[model samples]
Target: MKEFLSFIKKEFRHIFRDRRTILIVLVMPIVQIILFGFAVSTEVHDARVDVVGDLADPSVRQTVARIDQNPYLHVTAVLGSVAEVAERFRAGKSDVAVCFERNFDERLRHYDKAFIRILGDGSDPNTAQMIVNYVNGVLSTVQSELSASEGTQTASFPHVQYMYNPAVRSSYNFVPGVMGLILMLVCSMMTAISIVREKESGTLELLLVSPIRPVGVIVSKAIPYLALSLINLVTILLLARFVLGVPLRGSLFLLAVMSVLFILASLGIGLLISVVSATQKTALLISGMGLTMPTMIFSGIIFPCESMPVILQYVSDIIPAKWYIIMVKKIMIEGVGFSYIYPEFIILLVMTLFLLVVSVRLFKRRL
Candidate 1:
């Protein structure tokens, strides 16, 4: 008991003296949290739409207004002719175009069923399908409003055509999500083991004998791992870009910034693990059981959260990796901005602070 007390006291002394390690411990987790929170997400929103119709026609103008008002749709350009619409869709400047035949109101009055033709660029099937869904929803809403006064009448739909990804590739959803899971495992567990290895080897004591502090030793260990993690991040991103061919619709700068946050968050967790376990093997086992298993089950990477048993869904709330996976999927796949991701960010921040506080309290108790 006396020896354990003495060793813990020595650990505190080392921690206070090593300013570099302390800084890294404090800073690294935030970087990791930001990365996981902002760089990833699964859902897509605010897709660009093109409207090709006579702005002067009242019925066409009203339809355009409805499209513009929708939160999921953003009108990037308006076309005057079929030639212009075809050119934009073929150039990939637009995902879907709304074209109204000449004298749209006149035709509706005479035929009681004029169609607003929708043409979609089907280069990416999922995106093309999403575009059709959006247009269908818009047309439904417009017809629903028009039908309220007619008692009970079936409304005809404006024709919607899908261009590409007639079958949305399952790979489009799986590939990016897999990258998030892989990084979380490799970066966090690897760092945790490295720290615990120092404890298992006698060098941790030698470092204590030096002027360096416990925190400094931990930080130095973390720094090299963080670098390696970043290299892995770059490699994974490039593979997703060049090899898998995922589009980077969002800003790369923002992605880099968020990645660093998640890395730091993971490092803090690794340090906390080191402080708990006396042996490297114990640390590895605990880290795996604590982080990896739960993360895989709850992170919604493999299984959808909605489909999970109610209890399991609630259990997922505590898993940090679950939140990270959600955030990454939204940012990378959906191309949403920070405002859309703030709730996930706040949750991750809370988890990080909770972990830090717990580790600090534990360190003090052992001391």
Candidate 2:
């Protein structure tokens, strides 16, 4: 019993003394708790809604006011035509577009019913569904108020239309998320492990001493993984298109370019991890556990960034996967052109450059 107690104490000391062990065992849990506590939510909040057409009508104004007042919905725009609304949706500005009939109040007063269209961004099926349901609730509230005040029931029923994905397939949202997660993990994990394995085996030190420059060494290490990730990208695209039946709505060439940029960015992350990690186990832990949780949570894979708190939303911006996922959704599902996606493309480009510069600078010739 005394010997066993001594062994246990030694084990405890080993765990606490090793900074990597302490970080993985103690700090990761706290980060995950903070992310999940603030980031995860099934309910949509502050959904951006655009009210199009007859905003001058009293009843229409009342309905729009009620929609803005709803905790889950915020009326962001009052537009003249659905053509403008379509532009907004394609630009990824509006979530739900509520189109009221021309001279809506007149139609309501005279005909006892009027047409209203609820347009939602179907790239995100869950939020689209929730926004439509909430819009319906608000419309229903308006009808009840009308009946109570005028002693006559209104027969207006709001028509719902989902853009990009009329069927509102859950796969549309999930496929892009899966793509981001896979590329991020595989590129980062493989690159980090490959470099760290060389480091552990003493080969990296030998290579560092060779006539080849450090940049050459880094490029050689990255080239194989980059090619593999490209092949992996193609495989995922084919599977997503043919096997899963997800539509490829935009230019394939553009998608390929964007995907390559994302892969490079992920590879940069792996390089960054390799610089800080001394061994294979440490590299694996940092790349796998550290990258995976943040990519999944902050990348808005399973949750909407707009629904999270302001600070979390800002944090989501730093995750490369978030921007990639957004670009993928717009290109693959929404069919938006380059003008709509350039911002995300630029962001990934900047991140790749930044990570590579920092990684190379931190990388030393000395082991």
Candidate 3:
């Protein structure tokens, strides 16, 4: 009993001595709870609504006003043509577009039947469905109000159209998320472990000082992982396309290029982790436990960022996976071109450069 108590006391001291272990044990759970609690909501909050129709129509303006008044929806744009809906979507201007045909009020009055087209991006089918439901509820309220005011029993019919994912397949949303997670696992976690193993064996410094060039050493370590990650990417694409039946709508070349950029960014993260970590176990904890949750929650992978709180949405911005996943969804699901995705592409590129440069500088400074 005395020996057992002595060992327990020593174990407790050991655990409390490492600040990182304490942080992983204590702080990580708190952070996870807060993030998951606030960020995992499925209900669409303040969904961007663009009204595209004849602005002169009183009924059109009234409907817009009502949509704006809704607590969950905001009318962001009043466009003159339906052709602008896709442009707004590409520009990230709207979550849902409310389109009224020409002479909406006239048709509603005479024919007692007018159609309000509801357009939503379907890459994330769950959010798309939620947005449609919210918009439909608002439109139904407007339709009832208009009918009562005009002494007519007929209401404007809402026709919902989902872009990119007309079939509303959950796989459309799942594949990109899994892709981001897999690349992070391969490029970030594996690379971190590989470099930390060398550090643990005390061989990393010998190699660094052996005139191989530290940058070259880092690159050499990363190259094998990069090739393996690309192979994984190919496997994922094949599985997604043939086995799961997810469409590869955009340029396959473009997808590959974007994926390479993302992989490089992930490798940089791993390099940074290895630079800080003193042991292989530390590297695994930081690279594996540290990154996986944020990637899932903040990357818009399992949850839509738009539905999250403002601060949480901002948090998602710094995560590389978020941009990569967005670009992937746009390319794969929407079949959008380079012009539509240049912003995300540029963000990922800057992140890759920044991470690599910072990691290299830090590695040199530390070791």
Candidate 4:
């Protein structure tokens, strides 16, 4: 009991001595949650739209006002002709174009027929669809008003078809990406730091001086972490399946196999980090900033890769997490098989082999 108490006191000293680890442990999760929740959004907002055609009609002007007043959309350009709207859209000045037909008021009152074309720039299909929906809703309200004034009952409403996010619930897409990020974070970053922590405290030397081969030592370090990470993977899968209602459309066996392969890759990276880092603080710092942060940003874990700058997009190709995220997304959401995701799988395998080979070579050099 006395020895246990003394050991506990020594552990306390080790923890308190490293202010960096303490701060990271306390602040990292809070920062991640806040950053992910408030800043990362799948919903489009303040999308710019161009209103074209007859500005003289009061109904048309009202429609424009309604669109402009919407917080999600802004009528930034008012053009005279459809050609101008198309030109602006091609120039990337507008996400959507709202065109009011000629003789709009006369057509609505006399014929019970009105036409408006919502031309979209199809570059970002999701935002284009949303803007089109807003335009359609506005047109419906105006049509209803005209029918009410005429004492006529209307039957038909405008049709809206989403292009990219057809289902419109982004959680379907986000869950798999979230799983990839969690795996990378828990498996790669945590294992790296944990193993490096053992090294920093001199226990690694004692273990190495024993009968344990380097490979055995590495495997032993990874085994418990791999188990813990698999448990975490199961929890995340359950949350995604039951809690979030994301269907596992593809083979569960394939996802599990890929997950295990990914775990091995992650363990390789963690072991490499352990071998490189002389101290626990350095390992945590390198893993947190070098591995985790870039994975979060570049893996399409939160922000859409299509939305990122071209340079950043190119840089993202190198991140192993990006490939894993793509693999998971293809498997879970698109219901794709190994044949489709094989290229990315190959890339991941290649990266894992490369990291492991380099780490082994470096370990030999250090010895």
> How many steric overlaps are in each model, in order?
34, 0, 0, 0
Q: Which stretches of candidate 3 lie over 4 Å from their true place?
A: 1-153, 365-367
Q: Write candidate 4's Cα lDDT for 226-341 as tens digits.
A: 66567666766776677656678788888988888787788778777877788878887888888878887898876788899999999998888898888887788777889999
TM-score of each: 0.54, 0.61, 0.60, 0.65
lDDT of 1 by residue, 1-367 (tens): 4544454555545444667544443344335434443354333467778887788887788778898888778788888777887788777778788888888867765666667888877777657777778777887787766556444364555544433223343444555555555556655666666656666777666666766555555556556666656766776666666655665666676677667666667767776787878887888788779877777678776567888999989999887777766666667767778888889888888887776566545542122
lDDT (C-alpha) at residue 322 in model 1: 72
Residue runs of model 1 more than 4 Å from their true location after superposition: 1-167, 360-367
Error of 4 at 262 (Å): 1.6
Which 10 residues in a row give candidate 2 its minimum summed lDDT?
A: 29-38
Write down the lDDT that model 4 would get: 0.72
Which rank order by TM-score, best down to worst?
A: 4, 2, 3, 1
For this target, which candidate reaches the highest lDDT against the unseen true structure? Answer: 3
Model 3 scores worst on lDDT over the 10 consecutive residues at 29-38
Tens digit per residue, CA lDDT, model 3, 241-275: 88667899999999999999999999999999988
The alpha-carbon deviation from the true structure for residue 70 of candidate 2, after best TM-score superposition, in angstroms, is 28
Write the number of the candidate with greater lDDT, choosing between 2 and 3. Answer: 3
The 0-to-1 C-alpha lDDT of every candidate, in the order given, reads 0.67, 0.79, 0.81, 0.72
- Model 4 clash pairs are none
